[model samples]
Target chain A: MAEKKVIHFKIKRQNGPTGAPYWEEFKMDYAPNHNVVSALMYLREHPVNVDGKKIEPVVWDSNCMEEVCGACSMIINDVPRQACAALIDDLEQPIVLEPLTKFPLIRDLMVDRQKMFDALLKIKAWVPMDGSWDIHRHAPLIAAGEQSVRYLFSRCMTCGCCMEACPQFHQDSAFIGPAPLGQVKMHNSHPTGKYANEDRLHAIMGDGGLTDCGNAQNCVKVCPKDIPLTDAIAQLGRQTTMQWLRDMFVK
Target chain B: MADAAVDPNALGERYHFLIRRLHSLSGIVPVGVFLCVHMSVNASVLAGPARFQFAVDQIHKLANLGILKPVEVLFIFLPIAFHAYVGAWIWLTGKPEIMRYPHLDNIRYAVQRWTGIIAIVFILAHLWHVHWIIPGGTEFDAHAAAESAVNAMASLWVGPVYALGVLCAVFHFANGIWTFLITWGVTIGPGSQRRSGWVCGIIGVVLALMGLAALAKFKSMDVSALQHPPVTATGKVEPGAQTTGH
Candidate 1:
């Protein structure tokens, strides 16, 4: 009888945010269409390390178990990505996993992504509902070009990969970073949000605001959602200038 | 003192969260947008002092109007406050050990943040020296006023400050411009982003030099006329003729 094939894995482990980080190896029985997350689940059922010793169940955060949620994001072979989408067959042997670096570590694979979310709030990354709360209200018509731009921005899943890959984003930064700038582009594109456009412009106009970004472009490359962060920043640049001029003259 | 009353942890929790949000969004305006305008304005100096001064006067006039002044104040104050507040907050909360290294990416990021600190100091000093101190109504005569302006520029202390300010401004602007392009999605591909960075660096240096030259010219002018008063009934107004020894 032929032996069943198996997949090997090496994951960086940490007990908590402040706990010491270490490595553990595991081997999962090969199955068709298996992904990193699935293998992780298998290990959860049988929490044993390669050293032939029983260990605590590996800890990680995942919601959708699919690529859409972005909850299963981690570093695979030093590249930030969604674990759910990483196929075992596609990765090199001894698949490695680590938490995204740019965010605060929560545990083994979960990192605090509140910074990215907070940035969204700071930028007012929303269209003011105004009188449109009623479902019966007429929806605003969006031009095709505008729609395309908004669509590009809508892809952000609040995943921290962009932040993780960004060199400028760190524990010591007040840099609002690139992800939120993309959100600025998203919200500003909406007809309703355009009403408070000047406010949004004014918000990012300060010290640690847009000016803080060093334009490394690493954020866009690592964004799982493929949002056009760089483009949003440029548009905001032009928009803010107009706003600055308006603020100078009108009020 | 008032902040001391609040639970340090809770205060951190509430404000830290909001500040992170504000910091992230703040990039769209002052730093990102302002850099573009600043660079373009500095470029005008290449056209000569008249054009540069004209632009400055126009900006001042527009910015000084009643309603506009408040808004302008907000524009300047909010971003600086938010950026500084958030930056300090992050520094306080963040683990600095991991960031102490000198990777290329890390070095650039650190430099950018440090420049923010430098720019903030320079800006405050600039406001004090130029807007408030020198032009705030010390000199009664035009010549004296001009002399004061020139003297301010020529002073050993002030010269380095101006030079540093220009350098910091250009570095900040160039770095922000490079990031602005990426955040906006203008330079997506690796090749494009790298090329854009190079272009930004070159342009930033040129703008910095132009701004420095403009500032340096202010110091090079002859301030002798300023030191001397208008010829009076006497062959020349004694050094102490106009009492108060201005």
Candidate 2:
């Protein structure tokens, strides 16, 4: 008789936000095409440990089951990435899953990415112009070259992967992190978005603003969408300097 | 829309922008610029004890203008002290993820932080040994400079440690210049940054080489001749007060 093939997972489990975290090992029958989310789903169905004891099903957040949703971002094998995109075959066993340390943990592998969104809100990461407004017809033509950079910045899924990787983005710190900074670059580049550029820049200029970024360059490396975070930061640095000079003269 | 409430303690936002700017400005203007000058002066050891002493005397001569004290205190000491304290706070709060993430930038980031720390320790130790903790109760003046130079080379471990310190400090400054430019908005794109990186790299190598060359020169000096103080204008052996310590 052939022995049963199995996949192993070492998940850092927490009952709630304030609960102490502990690790639990789980075993599942080997199945083809099993990504991390699907493997977790298998664990959800069985709700048993490798020791043959029925246990609570593992908990994680996922919506798209694709990489786009950004809800399944966690530390898979000590690397913060999307669980939906991590295949079991590609990962070395036993796979380790933990929530991002930069954010408030909800439970198990899920974390609250609200701060990331809050940072976006603080930076006002949006074009001020209405979607229904067609002012581009009267304005000078925006070259495809300009749109290309904006397009790259628009791919951010707010996954918190960059935030997790950022050395400056800890829970106790005030750094706005790379995600919001990248959005500032994106929106500020837009034709109409430039109107409120100073406002956005001012928001980032304050407490957790641009100076807080240590230029670790970690944000660019971990970005799944290949956003040019460092470039945005560099550009913002120049804008802020100009703003400072302007302010200095005004004062 | 949620109101953008400004945090009172946010230094960058408030009148503290000057402080924040001073932090970055100090690193380059006084600290970074002074490192280059200090290394070049130290490199005079390549021409032997006489030339090295001469180089030291030249800097001391700045006192003739009655501005050297103020200049050193303001440009050299105060700026460095400010840069170090502010930097220590940032480094303490940072979370290095190179071990787990293993990305190139993350590795660089981690290295930068670690190097900054190492450089700070080395600088303090170097200052203490050279400036404050003079053996034999000798004031570290120009006459003692060459002997102290030889003293630092007397131990086998001292040379390598000195080299490592120079390497770390030079790297921190060089890599810092690159970051400083980006942070200040001078380098806006990949091309500019890449060019600036190459420039900083070249500067680092040159500075490191100059530092190591000085140490190597010190190692090769004739200790017998180094022990004797140089003659003054009156042809008498000048008493202690010449050499700058580690």
lDDT string for model 1 (B119-222, tens) is: 77886777666553325532322223334556557667777887898788678768766655655445655567679879989977777877776566656655
lDDT of 2 at A94: 94
Off by over 4 Å in 1: A1-4, A132-137, B1-246
Q: Could you tell me the lDDT of residue A93 within candidate 1?
A: 86
Give the CAPRI class of candidate 1: incorrect
| Alpha-carbon local distance difference test for all models | 0.67, 0.82
Q: Which ten residues in a row have the lowest lDDT in candidate 2 chain B?
A: B131-140
Q: For each model, chain A TM-score?
A: 0.93, 0.94
The candidate maximizing TM-score is 2
What TM-score does chain B get in every candidate?
A: 0.64, 0.82
**Per-residue alpha-carbon lDDT of candidate 1 for residues A1-251, written as tens digits (9 for 90 to 100):** 89868888899989998999999998868888888888899999989888779999888888887688778889998788899988988999889988887789988988888888777776778887755356776778999998986887888787777777666568777677787888887788788887767666666765456655554456666677778776676667667656655756897
Residue A180 in model 1: shift from native, Å?
Answer: 1.9
In candidate 2, what are the lDDT values of residues A4-93, reduced to their tens digit? 888999999999999999999998889989999999998999999878899888889999987888899999887889999999999999
